[model samples]
Target: MTGKLVVGITGASGAIYAVRFLQHAAQYFDQLLVVMSQHARSVARAELGIEVGDGEQCAQNLLGRPYPNITFLN
Candidate 1:
């Protein structure tokens, strides 16, 4: 079977959930896409001490390395 997973990270108190979900999804999904809202970027900076820019590059920094079917949408 083939599948895709779409995860949206919002600006809230549960940012870790998104990260954990991404890690888990990376293992199972054929295509994993994570989209972070602008507010979520702010939240990430505040909570994770990571600065997210306005493009895919910032997401790349956060995600680290590259997975074949993983995509980060800023």
Candidate 2:
């Protein structure tokens, strides 16, 4: 409850679910380590109409904001 959490997301149909989970999880965890697959961006764009960018902008693009406690793993 007071530690880090690692979340892995693939090229699934329901990308919104992952996004929602991360949003809620961020409140409970100290840090969030997100690992997204190559095709995850495409799925997100198709399903949620969100552009999951690269590098430091990935989280921002996915969550639609900046979260200091979130980190993307490559």
Candidate 3:
């Protein structure tokens, strides 16, 4: 098995930063744990216009690829 890492993203202006970081982290960790705040979600929608319907759909949008080592939590 490989190692893991945790990434927490709060309701900050730089929402893309978190996603971009995770995209890059895909190669570094076997498991990538992600946590996002309500404000972050709101900001993401407002800024990126990414209509992430439900939890599962939102998960797909954030990762932007197949279900890889990524998780989304509110």
Candidate 4:
């Protein structure tokens, strides 16, 4: 996938960084793929106060809205 951005969200201290990166990547890449680990959800809830469930729900929760070019990889 040329010019595509793949983001993996793990259990890191800076969930904000991932959020900001996604915002910026969305503007530049035509295709954006996001993979969120289970630990990432736990971190997000603790750090960002966001509870992300599994599968597409987790992706939808983080993104707020589904974009045409955005793909959620479970």
Candidate 5:
């Protein structure tokens, strides 16, 4: 209940779901390690109109805010 969580985002059709899940998960988890696929960025842009960048910016782009507990993996 009070630990880390790993979330993976792929180039699937439902990016909004991932975004929403991450937002809620951040509130409960101590740390969030996010692994995003290479095509996920393109899918995010196409579906959610978000420009996902590298490193920390990627998190902000997806979540629309900065979450200190969330870390994006390369």
Candidate 6:
């Protein structure tokens, strides 16, 4: 898939939505860049118990592996 995206996740307590979107879209998107804001981290920690201090790791866990198709920006 070829598209433009500016996905943003705030401190609303739902990282799964964004993570799931990336995993699902990775199947078709040629280039996927993820920009995870700082507030989202706390949300993940409070809601998901994933206090890793890195979006890449959380993303990998969500996708079940490392994918080169996505770029993670903390």
lDDT, candidate 3, at 18: 72
Which residue runs does candidate 3 get wrong by more than 4 Å?
A: none
Q: lDDT per residue, candidate 4, 1-74, as tens digits?
A: 23898888888789878877887688788898888888887888898888876655654677676566667788
| Tens-digit lDDT string for candidate 5 (1-74) | 38999988888888889999999999999999999997888888898899888887877888988999999998
lDDT (10s digit) by residue, model 6, range 11-65: 6767778767878888888878777677877777677667635556655654568
- Model 1: per-residue lDDT, tens digit, 1-74? 26998888888877667766777778888997778888888888788877767545654555554566767775
After superposition, the stretches of candidate 2 with alpha carbons farther than 4 Å from their true spots are none
Better of 1 and 4 by TM-score: 4
The TM-scores, one per candidate, come to 0.77, 0.91, 0.80, 0.79, 0.93, 0.72
**Candidate 2 Cα deviation (angstroms), residue 16:** 0.4
Score candidate 1 by lDDT: 0.72
* Tens-digit lDDT track of model 2 for 1-74: 58999999999789989988988898899999999997887899999888887788887899988877889988
Give the per-residue lDDT digits (tens) of candidate 3, residues 1-74: 37888778778887778767878887778987777777888878887776554565666776577556766655
Ranking by TM-score: 5, 2, 3, 4, 1, 6
Per-residue error at 8 for model 4, in Å? 1.3
**Global lDDT of each model?**
0.72, 0.88, 0.72, 0.77, 0.89, 0.69
Better of 4 and 5 by TM-score: 5
TM-score of 5: 0.93
Error of 3 at 7 (Å): 1.0
Task: Tell me, by TM-score, which candidate is best.
Answer: 5
